[model samples]
Target: MKKDVRGMLKDFTDGLAAISETNKANVNAFMRLLNTGYKEGALSTKTKELMSVAIGVYNRCEYCIVYHVYKSLEAGATREEIMEAAMVAVGFGGGPSMAYSATLLKDSIDEFENDFK
Candidate 1:
């Protein structure tokens, strides 16, 4: 994996974050809402992990993709569930991003394959 994602993203991600922080409170509010939802059981941890994987893939966030795959596995999601999340992601992001997300999750996916049964 590449050590630096700041380049591929061209600081675009950071710029978006910066813009969000300056423009309004939406980003933090959304994060707080999600946190509350997760803590209140309105959103299950597994579902959140799957959603994270989807977002990571769609956004072409390689590190996030890999981390979330492991997170889903740790949260007790099945292999099929993880793959389905990936499918849903690629459905939005197209082939290149899908391929990248899969590559990002490869080792962890292999490590957790048996847990999916």
Candidate 2:
């Protein structure tokens, strides 16, 4: 992988923090929305995280893919479950999504899957 998945996560975290320093209102709103979205609802948190993984892949958002993959595992999704979600994205998103699923998503799993165990 061109970028280490863990490093990408760290960088994203740092970047978010820096942005939050200046863009506090928007950042706080975004964080609230994120927390609300990820909170358990009709769907379990694990299911939500899996859905996020698929959405991230479909959108080709590298940082989102890394974050949600890690969160999915943390929420107790198995590697297989994560992959299945990514495949669902590929179905909708076609080759562009597949490319991310095959590359960045796979790398994110490799880098973070064991961390949950």
Candidate 3:
């Protein structure tokens, strides 16, 4: 069966929140660390998001890809930029990354854009 990537993401996030609630302090700390790492320093948020897209592709995590793609768009990364980042992942990860980028990345981008429109 075909996956509903957006729905799966929502469910995963909801599940994560529920799990995190059982250990709020630790989860909060981890979230804080994530926020701190992603915050603007030498690299802009958009740059970080682009990097995330590449990492997501290399890792072949659909959840990661969807989340980072949405975040990248919010951070003002154009489709072209995201695609370029995916290409970079393909360079490192070879065929697996290429497959993920061509399928999952494209689907995520289309889904995200459609939702916003």
Candidate 4:
């Protein structure tokens, strides 16, 4: 079935918050790690988010795809740049990554691209 990228993001956000209530310490640490990882460092946040998109596709994680696509856009990654990252994943992940890149990734881009504008 086709996934609702926006709804997936909302659910993920809500779920993360709920999970944090039950597992505060670990969740907080993970959140901190994410914050630190995404900060502008050796690479720009946009580059990191793009790399995340490729990793998500290669790993076939739906939530990761949606989340990182939204972040990639928020970090100022163009659709072309996102696609290029996904293609690099396809190079390593083969058919599976291509499938996701064409479907879920495309759908995510369609759903969230305008939100950043």
Candidate 5:
């Protein structure tokens, strides 16, 4: 969730709940660019998905970790790959962050596995 993003979630969720066409339009534009960069081309969207999970783990973003784990599957990432990515994040992100992120990521782990079946 990044450091300051927690404070912004309310407004963001509120805006989302309101179904503001303007916000949707603007976010769609951003999504196009991001999806192109991360999901298209030969960049291997799985890699980006893993990276997102790693960042979510590192930043301790509960919702982000959950969503990214799901998105990882939606992006064609495997459970082993996602687990390995989280392992790497644990190494680089350290004990507390690693532990916290693992707990958060755990919920999505099962869902991701089932998604493949």
Candidate 6:
């Protein structure tokens, strides 16, 4: 079935909040760490998002791909930059990365771009 990536993400996040309510402190801490790591530092946020897109492709995580692609766009990463990052993942992860780079990464980019429009 074709998934609405943005809707799926919203549902997942809402469910995650419900499940993590009992451990809110831990969840909040983890979120803080993620925020800190993704913030501009030595690397710009766009660079970090590109790196994340590569990692997401290497790992073949659909959720990761969707999330990071959306973030990469938000951080001003061009489609060319995202594709280059996916190619780097292919270098490291071989055939599997190639498959994801061609399919998942491309789909995520299209999905997110459509969502934003």
Which candidate gets the maximum TM-score versus the true structure? Answer: 4
Off by over 4 Å in 1: 1-37, 112-117
Taken over the whole model, the C-alpha lDDT of each candidate is 0.70, 0.94, 0.87, 0.96, 0.71, 0.85
Cα error, candidate 2, residue 38 (Å): 1.1
Which pairs clash in model 6? none
Per-prediction TM-score to the true structure, in the order listed: 0.61, 0.96, 0.91, 0.98, 0.71, 0.87
Q: Residue 44: error of model 2 in Å? A: 0.6
- Write model 2 residue lDDT over 13-113, tens digit each, in one string: 99999999899999999999989988989999999999999999999999999999999999999999999999999999999999999899999999898
In model 2, where is the ten-residue run with the lowest total lDDT?
1-10
Count of residue pairs whose backbone atoms collide, per candidate? 0, 0, 0, 0, 0, 0
Q: Rank the candidates by lDDT, best first.
A: 4, 2, 3, 6, 5, 1
RMSD of each: 6.3, 0.9, 1.5, 0.7, 5.6, 1.8
Estimate the lDDT of model 6.
0.85
Between candidates 3 and 6, name the one with more favorable TM-score: 3
Superior by lDDT: candidate 1 or candidate 2: 2
Give a tens-digit lDDT track for model 1, residues 5-108: 32423454565588786765887786678667556277789999889888888887766776677668878888778888888888888997667656765555
Candidate 3: segments with Cα more than 4 A from true spot? 114-117
Model 6: per-residue Cα lDDT over 16-114, one tens digit each? 698687988888888898899999999999999999999989998878887899999988887889999999999999999998878778877877765
Question: 4 or 5, which is superior by lDDT?
Answer: 4
Ranking by TM-score: 4, 2, 3, 6, 5, 1
Residues 1-115 of candidate 4: C-alpha lDDT, one tens digit per residue: 7888889999999999999999999999999999999999999999999999999999999999999999999999999999999999999999999999999999999999998
Candidate 3 global lDDT = 0.87
TM-score attained by model 6: 0.87
In candidate 3, what residue range of length 10 has the lowest lDDT sum? Answer: 108-117
Model 2: C-alpha RMSD to truth?
A: 0.9
Clashing pairs in 5: none
